[model samples]
Target: MDDQRVSILERIGLEKPLVQAGMGGVSRHLLAAAVSEAGGLGTIAVPGAAAIASELAAARSMTSKPVAVNLLLPFARRSWFEAAAAADVVVTFWGTPKRRVPGIWLHQCGSVDEAHAARAAGADGVIVQGVEAGGHVRGTEPALELLERVKAALPDYPMFLAGGIATRTDVENAVASGADAAVAGTRFLLSDECVAHPEYKQRLLSANSTILTELFGFGWPAPHRVVANEATASQAGPSGEIPFINKLINRASAAGARFTPESVQRRAVAHQSPTSRMLTPHAPSEDLPRRFVEAGPLYAGETVARIDKLLSAEKIVTSLVG
Candidate 1:
């Protein structure tokens, strides 16, 4: 890597150019702190302002290293910006690029156009997410393929590659392909520090394939990649319109609530509702029903097939970039 790339990593206090993707509710204080302390950038997914603030404080208490917070722009309320701004690095995804904080801002882009827009909007960096990524995918192409296109378009911009990254070779390839860093989500979700339920983790260990579907798009409506399970088997197909009832519940969840701690908590636990399939298996007290292991969205990247063991977050970071 060149000086510019080194500086980008240094600016964010990342000794290793690896970032743990902010998997909503799953990537909490323990996971984030563990990654940061292990030399990579750790990120906490923010559902709302209150959760962001609380998570940041908790992560800070665990490690003095710098940490990041991610906000899903499409579902984020305006007040969430305040809490997001407090983090060392703020990352936004799934919407238009806008500077809501004075800190280093990075936007996740699904296409070259979105990458350009993020750069034009003054983003310090951009994460290129491809179809192989878990959770809500942004691009239809493969991760490295999209990374190449965006890098050619914005040669000088800081870029990170996300999706299907699980091993040391994956990080090496990302850096060699002109990425300043590599971001991994599914791999981290299986880490010891991650809060994903044991059953969910077991499923990932055995899963060999992932399907992209919009079935759990009740509130988000975006295509997400997940391991095949009962929830996905019930879906008619890979693509379709979100159900009317889901849209209603999604709107109701966001209706007129300020981004306070209480309101944020409600939205974070929205999966607990019987009607929604977006279960937060990371939340121990959510009282997720037994069927959730097979019925809820078990987000995973294409790399899930290669991951078989649950390692510590620190061990995972070291294995990737040591």
Candidate 2:
């Protein structure tokens, strides 16, 4: 590895250039601790301040290795950032670039402009998330394609490649393409450490396809890629295009977010708001209601088609870094 890559790995206390992406609700102490213990950087994703603090503590207790915390800008509360301060690294996504944690802070970006803005904001690194990535996508370019663009714009900057990574070759290719590390979400989402519902995991085990859609926009109406479900089937046409009314809802929701208070946004997360009918970023967890399983978004990356089995977090780490 080059000095930039080596420096980032050393700073984050990682042995391999791999990160198990922080997933909302799905990623927790067990998964984070396991990934870190297995020599890859692990992250405790957002739930709440108490949950973050508790998960961070539990993860630390289980593994002396470094563990990171993820805070989604749209859903993050001040308390969430405050609680994440105890983590080794704080990873932020979406919104304007800003440093919320004291330790190594990395911002996940979708474009070169976002990467440059993150650098100006004093981020220690950036995870370049491509549109092919699971969850809420922010960039239009392919992961490696954008990785190179970001590299040319900011040489020596620590960059991790996200999206389109599901195998060892993908990891190696990312580093060869200038990424300091490879960040995988869909692969890890299928891991045993992840807390996704068994039905959800089973669904992805055989998943041969995925679609990008704006139909899931309820709490946070953003473009997200997910496997087709009853909800998507009912609304999206055979071409996967949502009806005119659905598109209007997404546009209105995106516009409303600008004026909506953070408190109200947080309330919507609990399914207690006027827009509770829409979907947030939450993946299906244990007993999230059959209604959710049938209709809720089952976020997966384009690479989900290749992941056929569940492995322990440690094994997943070893596979990615192979």
Candidate 3:
């Protein structure tokens, strides 16, 4: 690695150039700490300031290694940034380039243009996400293809490649293609530390194909890739419009957040917020809500077809690095 790249990695305490993607709800304390402990960058996904602080603290308690926090810029409130600034690294996704963060900040981008924007906005690095990525995809092209394009455009910039990465060879290929690191979500989702419901993990294990749809577009109206399920099948014809009532609910939530006390908002953002309930993984003790299983988004990447067994987060990181 170049000195610049090495410095960037060191800033985030990455001994191995592998990142456990910050999958909302799924990438909580246990999973993040495991990856960090094993030498890769582990990221916790949370939206509000309090949740970010608490999760970071939890991860810190497990490992002295550096940890990162991910916040979806579109959903982040001012309080989120305040809390995230204390983390070793802050990663933002799904929004235009903006640097309201302190410390080393990285932005996940979908295209060359977005990568340039991120660089111009003073991001320490950029994660180029391809269409094949799980959850909310940002790029229209394949992961490697997008990585090559962005690398060509910004040859000296520190970049991470995300999408369809499942094995050690995938990580090697990403590094050979000019990526400083590789980010994996679907592979980590199957890790023992992930909080994904047993049923959800089983569905991923059995799924052989994925589809992009706007079915779970209540709060965030964007195309997300997932295994085909009853929820996806029910949406006949074009993606139906988000219900007016749901729109009202989303608006009300945002409005309510502004007036709500910081302590209350912190609690609400993770549990009661519509976005959290819709996207975050439910507790393992909760029975797999059939309605959610049928309709809620089961985000996975194209690599889902290749993963079959669950492993420890540390094992997953070792396998990818080896």
Candidate 4:
């Protein structure tokens, strides 16, 4: 693509219009820096910034490129906001735009109405993520319609389209629809740099249609698009109670204890019924159980089906740009 054709990409100091959407726990140091180094926009979720300054340092050490840190609204701890205030860029997710940061604030919006609201609330930019996204399901309108409405309502704002964006056609379609850029999560999730567990990537790559569970927390009612794992398959409807194993995981995590696979399995076995056998050997960390139990449906997008192999950040950027 010509330089002029990707004006917004240049404005963001990127060679491509693709952005690696921040995936909270999964969007850590290595992944974020690699994405930026590869000439695409990279965003880091700073949930662990307060606790693990080393992670932030690792990201900084990896690249000098512009990196945005995600700020989740209504977090039990406000450290993420503080981290955002100090970041090169800030993205607000699952939160009301009441807090103002010095850096650019890319407020998460599901519809044109929300985009306008975010603009009015002082967001520097608005990321228009549609319902087809992997991690969190937001908005009822399809991506194309929502982008049209957003472009019509906020002509001056730099609007970015997200959700189920993976292939070159998706990028072309986003630009044709007046989007300044396109954000993709599931595509990046399958990359070699993504910190997601091996099993997580494998599951995402092999699954046809992952389950969308509405049980996760962090305020909004976003759905998690997870592959049908033992944990996800066992999840009940919205009314189903959170198991004691998950409760213990939450409790222990809040107290500053690191969760390892063994510890989590022990806690899970103790809390869950004898029939529960969701724990598997290949799982990388104990956090998987917590993510499945507490943060299920493991938010994913429809585009995950297209991801066949893990890719390097540079290769990923080139493919996205093409």
Query: Which numbered prediction scores highest in lDDT against the true structure?
Result: 2
Tens digits of per-residue lDDT for model 2, 1-322:
7887889889888888889898888899999999999999998885678989999999999999989999878667788899999998899998898987789999999999999999999999999999899988998988888888999999989999999999999999998998888999999999998988888888889889998877677546678888877767777656557767766666667655545665775555456221334555557776465456556678899999999999999999888885
* Global lDDT of model 2: 0.84
Candidate 2 has its poorest 10 consecutive residues by lDDT at: 272-281
Query: Per model, how many backbone clashes are there?
Result: 0, 1, 0, 5
Error of 2 at 223 (Å): 0.7
Task: Give one digit per residue, the lDDT tens place, for model 1 in 119-221.
Answer: 9999999999988999889989998999999989988889999987999999999999999999999899999988877888888899998887666654456
lDDT of 4 by residue, 1-322 (tens): 4344354455556666778897866777788888888877887764444633556677889898877777666452455466556656677776566546765667888877778788888876788887678776666677878888888888767778888688888888997888877888888878888777666777777877765554332123334555555454454433334455644444444333222334564464345421242322122222455444332334568787777888977788788875
Quick one: best TM-score, which candidate?
2
Which residue ranges in model 1 land beyond 4 Å of their true spot? Answer: 238-287
Q: CA lDDT of each candidate?
A: 0.82, 0.84, 0.80, 0.66
Better of 3 and 4 by TM-score: 3
In model 3, the Cα lDDT at residue 294 comes to 54
Give the winner by TM-score: 1 or 3: 1
Weakest 10 consecutive residues of candidate 1 by summed lDDT: 278-287
TM-score, one value per model: 0.88, 0.92, 0.87, 0.79
